[model samples]
Target: MSIEQRIHAHYAGLSPQERRAADLILDHIDDLALYSSAELAEMSGVSRATLSRLYRHLGFGSFTELRETARTLRQQGVPLGPDGDPELSQHLDQELRNLRKVLDPAGDDRTARAVSDLAGARTVLVVGLRNSHPVALHLKQQLQQAREGVRLAPLPGQTLGEELVDVGPGDVVVLLGFRRRPSGFERLVSFCAQTGARTLLIADGTARRHASSVDLWIECPLGSVGPFDSYAAAMSLVAVLADGVLAAAGEDGRRRVSRTAEVYAELDELDLR
Candidate 1:
């Protein structure tokens, strides 16, 4: 049986103290990922020994077993992993797998959807701060090339607000913000909620809003490329998304972008030896 169901079946039988422990466990399975039995106990306010006992009563052979069960349950629907930096550079295989799972789920439909959202957008605003900013700017550049009204605001304060104030229904906000909390991403998302703009956030972990709340969410594995979290997987996601949109924007957007490129207006024409 599932951890939840097993716990719930014995719910009426649990003593008040056990119930308290149960409540804590149920609400915070993910936090348990980082906790030892003692740490879990401290957070749950149950004694470490009692916490172990409570999980035992729930049918786990050990605390690790309980944690693993909870982990599996939490990840059932989402495509992701533990919250860590992309710059860590330790887990390329894991990151690649995560990217594939998310992008290939339903055969690149997610990427296609991201593009469709762009093709339909009247204005597109992309936001990210700190280690995440450059990726957001990269996405904005792609959208601009597709002839969308795309703008990326500098981090912090009213500059972001002014950008968001312009978003309305039929607009898309593609936000990239992750662990350690990217400044201003959450507040912008909340503001957009009121404006009725569509929001798509790329963040870390399984939480829909790892750094900030958003409408559509894609979870990218954190990695490291030297000091920066490896955005390899994140970059792959954006590349695929841009390709999908560029392809979906059809003859009109294609013609417009092609004209600009052909005339070398913003497009540069340089000969290389």
Candidate 2:
């Protein structure tokens, strides 16, 4: 069993002091590998002996064993928290690293090809689920400004089957599939393939499993100092991709954008204030 499971199993049997330490351990489970027993004891406001007893009760032979177990969990893509509270500078550094990987020049050819597909397709469908929805919506909005025939899937209460019914040749499907994707995501990709629609997958490392199935895959790094995954790089890539599509459309795209602005002004659709 995992360290967490062990802790819960023996939680009721722990002494008051051991329970205190256990509570602290549970709160910082992600950072367990980074803390020494002494540091944990200090942070938990308990004696070192209490920490020792707590680990023992958790089925760890020693503190080192406990830490190693936490490390292994982290390596398996578990969203582990930082050793301690992270500063703004640390968060910025991680975001910069992610952007560097996403904007790397080595993948210029891939980006160019994706842009060409989006630019030439007769219809473009942007799909995103869960945390990926906003990005998909934003990409669809941007693409629409560049040209017509752009739409977002699963609009509010709708299902993907309805949106995908007409997707086929001369169509491009942009799928934003980040981590924590639903079980049926792979089947969605397969369905797109069966319909003869060109597919582009923009996702984090977890989507590498499906990379081979799609026509194009753009991987974005989402490591963050905190527990939650960051999407700064993914958002930046969307901007770059939208710009590429706009450039590919040339004067036609410019005219469409101008006309869109004119309509928005006529309808007072935007709140500039």
Candidate 3:
């Protein structure tokens, strides 16, 4: 079992002070590997002996063993925080590398095919869950400016079935599936297939297994120097896809954008100041 599992299994038996330390460790689990026993004890307002006892209760023979377990989890791609804060230059270099993969010329053909479907589809549904939601929503907003049929799926307090039930041939479903996707994600893809809707999947490397199942797949590298996955490349890809859709839309897209600007002016909706 992992450190987290061990903590939970023995949590009820821990002394009050040990529980305090355990709680602190759980709260910052991602950074657990980066913290020394002394740092954790000081931050948790617990004695070093309490922290040592907590480690033993959590099934770790020593604080070093606990840290080694956390490091092992990190090596298995658990998104543990880096050993030290990354320098700005290092972060920039990593972002640039990710952007290069996203903007690679080899993927242009696949992108064009996706844009063609988005431009021509009778209905377009953009779906995302968890971290992918913001990217999907942004893409939906951009697509709406280009065409009339764009829609966002599973709106607040909604479920996918309600939006996907009506999808069929001539419709397009764009799925933004980053890492840590829900277990049912593959099932949703299969359902879209059953509806005969064209599917476009934009995801990080973790979703590669599902690539062959979709009509088109765009891989966005999300490597980051910090604990959380970076979405800069994903967002850049959204911009590129939106631009392609606008261009493919021809004069119609231009007219829609113009009309939207007019409405904004008429309602005084935008804060120009």
* Global local distance difference test of model 2: 0.89
Please state the error at residue 39 of candidate 2 in Å: 4.2
What TM-score does structure 1 among the candidates reach?
A: 0.59
Off by over 4 Å in 2: 1-5, 14-20, 36-85
Could you give candidate 1's per-residue lDDT for residues 108-196 as a string of tens digits? 45566667787788888888776678788888777777765888876456556667767789888887766655455556668766788
Which 10-residue window in model 2 sums to the lowest lDDT? 70-79
The count of residue-pair clashes in candidate 1 stands at 16
lDDT of 2 by residue, 1-273 (tens): 987788889999999889888888888887887789999999989998888888777888899999989876664457887766799999999999999898988656888888999999999999999889988988998899998899999898899989999999999999999877888999998888788899999998878988999999999888888877888898898888899999999999999999998999999999988
For model 3, where is the 10-residue window of minimal lDDT?
Answer: 74-83
lDDT against true structure, model 1: 0.70
Better of 1 and 2 by TM-score: 2
Query: TM-score: which is higher, 1 or 3?
Result: 3
List, residue by residue over 172-265, the lDDT tens digit for candidate 3.
9999988778889999888887799999999988889899899999998888888768899999988888999899989999999999999999
Badly placed stretches (over 4 Å) of model 3 are 7-79, 106-108
